[model samples]
Target: MPLTLPLAELEVGKHLYWQLGNLKIHGQVFLSSWVVIGALLALVVVGTRKLERDPRGTQNLLEFVWDYIRDLSREQIGEKAYRDWMPFIGTLFLFIFVSNWGGALVPWKLIHLPSGELGAPTADINTTIALALLVSLAYFYAGLSRKGLRYFEYYVEPTPIMLPFKIVEDFTKPLSLSFRLFGNILADELVVAVLAFLVPLIVPLPAMFLGLFTSAIQALIFATLAAYYIGEAVHEEHH
Candidate 1:
């Protein structure tokens, strides 16, 4: 017998929506992404306001995260560029990390809208692609800023003989980054959805735990690669 896969029909407007009109203040609408961004912004604001020298509560937790990312940057990119890249890397890690895990905890199903409901922003292709683009832009800018006109030299590295390969390698970075994140998040969502359908209860508990782990790892990988790209863009030829 052929195995039958469960198909859930997700109506575009019901699960996702976009508004178009002159009356719209925002050009494109994405409630899920907006909510994720809003939550991150709120965390930043509250964390900063609550900062204490002798850290306690949320301040202590934020400091721990900051320290962890700072160390990660130093390990992957080295101390020279780590300081400059810390803020961006730290923000990326925390934002993506939170967004991924938050998807599991948020009462998305409990709250009903005209559309289906909110899912993890990072789980969406558009959101992951946007992140990849941002990372690309960051490293491109870093290259230009660090090496001036010579930044293009990376595309012709080893020798002019190797230009084609170098260019191909450079171009693949963003594509790999985008797809890796998209694939992992998409897989996690699918697993959760399928398990919820088939087992519906006790069986999904293990999958949920696994999903949480996968989510954190995906965030870390993205941030690590981002830091690595920035490091390569700025590093001296010998280093």
Candidate 2:
């Protein structure tokens, strides 16, 4: 018999579905997503349960993460409106970061799913597309809420020649964001699975670490761009 690696399968194209009155849902994705979200909630609850002035343990970690997110949102969204959107931006950052990390770190093989195996939520196109759409919505909302009907003027500012291009940009933006995230994460997971199959020991460690790093970077990029888009929408031009 030849060598066999069960994990090499990785279940890339397979999706587990949940039935709901003729509506089919990606059950695995939602299951994994809930796991990721639950973990974040648990962390927050545990971390803040015993808050101390001179923090230690989980509190310190939460404080560090909180401060990092605050700075990141403030830097991109600016001082004036950053606070208003910090929670949204921070949620995106944490959700993606944890989801990516969970997919890579968790040994889903050990946990039995109803159908297919679970992987990173980001690896799914639907998840990324949903996230990108949310960002796009945030951009429009930020502009409209702050500037009212005048927000449409952004397309024609500096010159009317830019109107068509700006309109096209709205469509392209979400496509770019979703595909970039989905491709990178899915590719990363597949590569690691292959490496683990070939070497099965020391070789996959480096790739795993790299995956974690890249996942974090992707999350940061998504959150930063989201903040920037919102910031640009709400920006005032001084003539």
Q: List TM-score per model, in order.
A: 0.86, 0.93
Instruction: List per-candidate RMSD values in Å.
Output: 3.7, 2.6
Cα lDDT listed for each candidate = 0.77, 0.91
**Between which residue pairs do clashes occur in model 2?**
none
What is the overall TM-score of model 1 with all chains considered together? Answer: 0.86
Q: Could you give me the TM-score of model 2 versus the true structure? A: 0.93
**For residues 19-63, what per-residue lDDT tens digits would candidate 2 score against the true structure?**
899998899899899999999999999999999999999999999
Residue 75 of model 2 has an lDDT of 92
